[model samples]
Every structure is written in structure tokens, then in C-alpha cells.
Target: MTQTLTLTWTTVCLLDRLEPDRGVAALVDGVQIALFRTADGLFAIDNRDPVSGAYVLSRGIVGSRDGVPTLASPLHKQVYDLRSGHCLDLPGVAVARHEARCRNGLVEVRLRQEG
Candidate 1:
């Protein structure tokens, strides 16, 4: 038997409020999530930097590496793939990625379940 999973999405902000190639921080369910608006699309990831232990990913530089959207940590400059939350500069390190979308001009985010 297969079970269906339902996700609760939180409305963060208006899509137009987010500038392209920038990021913003939002607290969803007491968890800090960083939302980014890039040329590729909207992405959501943990605001905390695993290596630096700082909630600064939202302020990280938005760029691309090898055609993959990336966010570079402002503290240590660790590059992370925005889609998968995988650290590019440091292997075996990653942040939590959340599902984000735009509905009726509002940006919504669904926290990713972690085991």
C-alpha cells in the first residue's frame, strides 16, 4: 500500500516583492528559511549556515556555478547548491532545502521533512 503525504505550505510574501538575484529570510514553524529569487526560479533553503552556525544564508551572494544555481556563504564563502542544499566547496555538508512556489502572486514555502 502507498501512503499519501500532505504538506502544509506557509505564505511568505508577494512574488513581486522579491527582487531578482536576491534572498530574504522568513520564519516558518519557528524555523528560519532563506528564500531566493533567481533567474532560474524561486528556491528555499535553511537560513543557518551549517559551517558557520550563523543565520546568514539569506544574505549570501547569489550566483551560478557550472550552470547550477548557488548561494555563497557570507562568512566563510562556502558555496551551496540552492536546489539541493549541497555544499559545493565542502563535501559531505549540506543544508535543508524546502519546497517553494508562487500561488496567486504570493510566495509559499513548505518545510522539508528531515529524519
Candidate 2:
């Protein structure tokens, strides 16, 4: 059986307002999410840096590693995959990644549910 999941998308800002290769912070349902606009596409992840306990992921440097979009934490410079939120520098550590899309020039974000 296939289960259907409903996602509530929150409109964050205008797509034109976001510059390419940069990140912005938004609060959805009391959770802080970091939204990134890269040449590849839009990506969302938790704003809190797991290494330094700092809510500064939005300020991370945006770049690519081996053709994969990545964000390096501003505090500790730990690179994280924007698509999977996996820490490339650390083993078995990851950040929460969310769904982000552009609809009618608006940037919307959907929080990913964790099991």
C-alpha cells in the first residue's frame, strides 16, 4: 500500500529577493531553517550548527565539493551537503534537510518530518 503524505508549505520570501549562492534564515512552525539558493537549485536545512551549537548555518559559505552543493559552517567550517545535510567532515553526523521550492515567484519551504 502506498501512503500519501501531506506537507504544509510555508511561504518564506520572493525568489528574486534571494541572491544566488547565498543562504537565508526563516522560522517555520517555531523551527529555524536555513534556505540556500545555489546554481543547482534551492535547498533548506536546519540553521543550528551541530558542532558549535550556533544558529548560524544561514551565514555559512556556499560552495560545491565534487559537484555536490555544500555549505560550510561559519563557526567550525564543517562542510555539509546541501542535498542530504550530511557532514562531510564528520562521521555519522547530519543536519535536518527540508523541502524548498519556487511557486509563482515565491519561495516556499516544507519542513521534513523525522521518524
Candidate 3:
């Protein structure tokens, strides 16, 4: 069975705090998350590098595979699925995906919590 967790979205920082080609790490209820805003003022990806177990995915290169947004790892070239948190290049590698929404000029990441 699938369990659904409700994660509260909190504004950890401002949008201007994020720079191009880099990401910011934030903690929501003990969960480590990375947020990245693309250079074009669109798109954000969590910075967790599942392959290397490092929070360096934010520092990875941002590119698209046939228009699909993807984040490359800084340590390794492993790419992950930003929306579903799946590893395209590697099988069985998945990252924690959060429900993110932008509202009132603030970006909020919905975290999942256990009841």
C-alpha cells in the first residue's frame, strides 16, 4: 500500500538568494532538501545526490533531455528525474520527491509527514 504524508511548506529563504548553476539546502521537519532555480527564472530542483549520498546535486549542471528537465550530479555524472526523483541513467536509484508550489512570491515545498 502507498502511504501519503502531508508536508508543510515553509519559506526558508527568498528567491533571490538562489543563484544560477547552484542550489540551496533546506531542512523541513528533519528532511534535508535542496532547492535550485534555473537561470531563466524558471524551474527548481532538489539538491540531494542519491548516488554519492551528498547534498551536491544543487551544484550540478542543469540541462534538458528532449525538453525534460534534469539535474546532473557534481561528484558523478548521474542524472536524476526532477519531478519524480528517479534516476534515468541508473536503475533503482530514486530521490525523495516533494510537492513544490509557488504562492504569493514564495516558493513552498510540501513535505510528507508520518502520522
- Per-candidate TM vs. native? 0.93, 0.93, 0.80
lDDT against the true structure, each candidate: 0.93, 0.92, 0.68
TM-score of predicted model 3? 0.80
Between candidates 2 and 3, the one scoring higher on lDDT is: 2
Q: What does candidate 1's lDDT look like per residue over 19-61, in tens digits?
A: 9998899999889999999998999999999998999999999
Between candidates 1 and 3, name the one with more favorable lDDT: 1
Task: Residues 1-115, candidate 2: write the lDDT tens digits.
Answer: 5543436999999999999988899999888999999999999999999988889999999999999999999998999999999999999989989999999999999888664
Worst 10 residues of 3 by lDDT: 38-47
- Look at candidate 3 and give me any clashing residue pairs: 7-111
- Report lDDT (Cα) of residue 27, candidate 1: 96
Q: Can you give the lDDT of residue 44 in candidate 1? A: 97
Which candidate number maximizes TM-score? 1
Which of candidates 1 and 2 is the stronger one according to TM-score?
Answer: 1
- Better TM-score candidate (2, 3): 2
RMSD of 1: 2.8
Q: Rank the candidates by TM-score, best first.
A: 1, 2, 3
State the RMSD for candidate 3. 2.6
